[model samples]
Target: MTDSLKKINKQIRFLSVYAMVSSVLLLIALFLILKKDRITGNLTVEELTANRINIVEPNGLPRLVLSNVEKSPANLNHGKPFGIPGGNRGGLIFYDDEATECGGLVFSGRKDSSGKYFASGHFSFDQYNQNQVLYLQYLDDNGDRKTGLYVDDWHNSPPYPEFRRTYKETEKLPNGPERDAKLKQLLEPVNGDPAFAHRVFIGKDANKASLINLSDKKGKPRIQLIVDSTGEAKINFLDSAGKVVYSLPNKANH
Candidate 1:
């Protein structure tokens, strides 16, 4: 081949190589720009708005929900009904690792048909797949107000699955004796069994008295230390039937 032709071939090969390298570099630059757009380290906004917001784990498990009454999600595992519009309740609800509702803080207040004012704030934590085991509550109905902390017992008979089944069954029944009977039957084991009872109560009662009431597994208030709204203090020891077996200042002054 001619030397001039050979030189021309060499120049062509170099141009082709340069073109491939330039294309690859351009592709890499474009890719980097696109990737940068996707990666956000920070954001600034004047406000954020939503009816319901769920905060989830990396694996898409819901950890928490912030919702208004109309948008509150139902706790199907716990047999909780869905929120109704204009229910006048709203708060943050939390979920367990299994995405089951464990507890939440909720508040509601409104005037009733009798024009009586009512308000309540509740913070509760539930046992696994069960109803609330601990609750702190404030309630104002009409002019009467009470604030208290409660601890409840758990029973094995109406396990979560059974509870859910019974709840669904009851929902299908109308408001009548049949429904009442069914409900009583369902609650009998839990209510009648001494093993499952309200274990502790400490706070102001409906009578406007501050008291710490201690109960046995049988649900009998065995002891009560109370200070009435009038600042009278007393200590009482009670029998299983709750008759004051022994009391300071006796029954008359108490």
Candidate 2:
């Protein structure tokens, strides 16, 4: 072959190789940038769904997989991957010392069908017992769905960790961000109703009071009853030591 012809062929070959390598490198760089954006929530759900690829982060941690992945806090069940799906791993579920950590709250209050979410057991108390903390939780995230009275308050001290927690008040209460308005609406008695005409009263044996059927509001009947030939009235109370204090009979319950 002629020298001029050979030189021309060599130049063409080198250019072809360079173009192929550059194309592959550019594609790789684009893929990496797109993946990084997804992990930081920059990619919308719609974008991710169409992408079909899992959004993996540093350490190759898969934070989410389009619409096919879910994750939970570690110690979720004391298992690996913490409690998340998608293979995303956080070192561990952090355990805070100064804050109290207990399970979710649950209660069988009368307002709701199943129950309210109050503090889990492992109660807390102030030195004076005056500022007691009944483990309370947010069942609805708003604290308006449940009540402590209906769900027998289980007062038992547990370890207090260092995060924020809610508590229920049995007798002594705290001045937190004021009782939730909805809570008051649910708890207040229906006033001016002929059905609940009876008023609450206190006496030495106020339990023995004679009833005239919601006559005056001193202490009235708790619930309406037809009283069959064989039925008994029951009462429940607590004592000084934070135990069932006393239980009296419903004398006027006839």
Candidate 3:
């Protein structure tokens, strides 16, 4: 071939290779951008499996966590841990905007040796920085079961960790009047009233009675609407001491 023709052919070949490289680079850049968009936007997958998954906000504050028993997280208050480490059971824990533990649903059911079995499920929500104020729980141990919806009261003066610390301190003391008095004082922080109480319970008890119990501030049952296992129904109203003062069908009627 002539020199001029050979030089023109060489130039064309170089340009062709450069164009191919540039096109490949452009395709790669587009793929990267699209991948980032999928990450920040919505990603669909057929299956997901993980020991723990934390859904967080832009600020890295966790809003929810789904975890197995071994990977569950400790309770949090204002982004800090308190009380005990979690990992007690598998469940989902929810948090507030401040990263405080707001609520959770945990469940466990297992059969041990000797044919003994136990199962429990608890769903609860706290009262802001305080302890659980409402819950639905089911407990079954060797055929003895209690399922209930509970409404509780918590102290507003101290945070839950502080209250727990005080209780633990009191528990370490020798069992006697002094320890009892300290425990009592810890629970009754404001005036002589009880700080925490189970205000309401509506469910079946271990005794095979379906009942709705409404208690006083001190957690003493004041009114009970019961349907016993025998299908007998009764409404009882008690005084502060919890002694039944009145009944729907009086003893004479019975």
Measured by TM-score, the strongest candidate is 3
| TM match of model 2 to true structure | 0.29
- Candidate 1 matches the true fold with a TM-score of 0.72
Candidate 3's clash total is: 0
Compared with the true structure, what per-residue lDDT tens digits does model 2 show for residues 89-195?
21112221212112322122223345544332222222111122233222232253321211122212221110102223321345443555323432332342221
- In candidate 3 the C-alpha lDDT for residue 30 amounts to 97
Q: Compose the digit string of candidate 3's lDDT tens values, residues 1-254.
A: 69999999999999999999999999999999999997686877999989999999989999999999999999888999987787787999989989999999999999988889999999999998888999999999989999999999887878887888889888999999999999989988778778899999999999999999999888999999999999999999999988998998788766
Number of clashes in model 1? Answer: 0
lDDT tens per residue, model 1, 1-254: 69999999999999999999999999999999878776744557799989988888878878888989987776645333433223345898888887777889999998978888989999999888777879999999886888999998766655555675676779799999999877766665555664257889999988989999998876778989999989999999999888988888776674
Give all TM-scores, in the order shown.
0.72, 0.29, 0.88
Tell me the lDDT of candidate 3. Answer: 0.92
Whichever of 1 and 3 has more lDDT, that candidate is 3
* Angstrom error at residue 240, model 3: 0.8
Candidate 3 deviant stretches above 4 angstroms = 1-28, 31-35
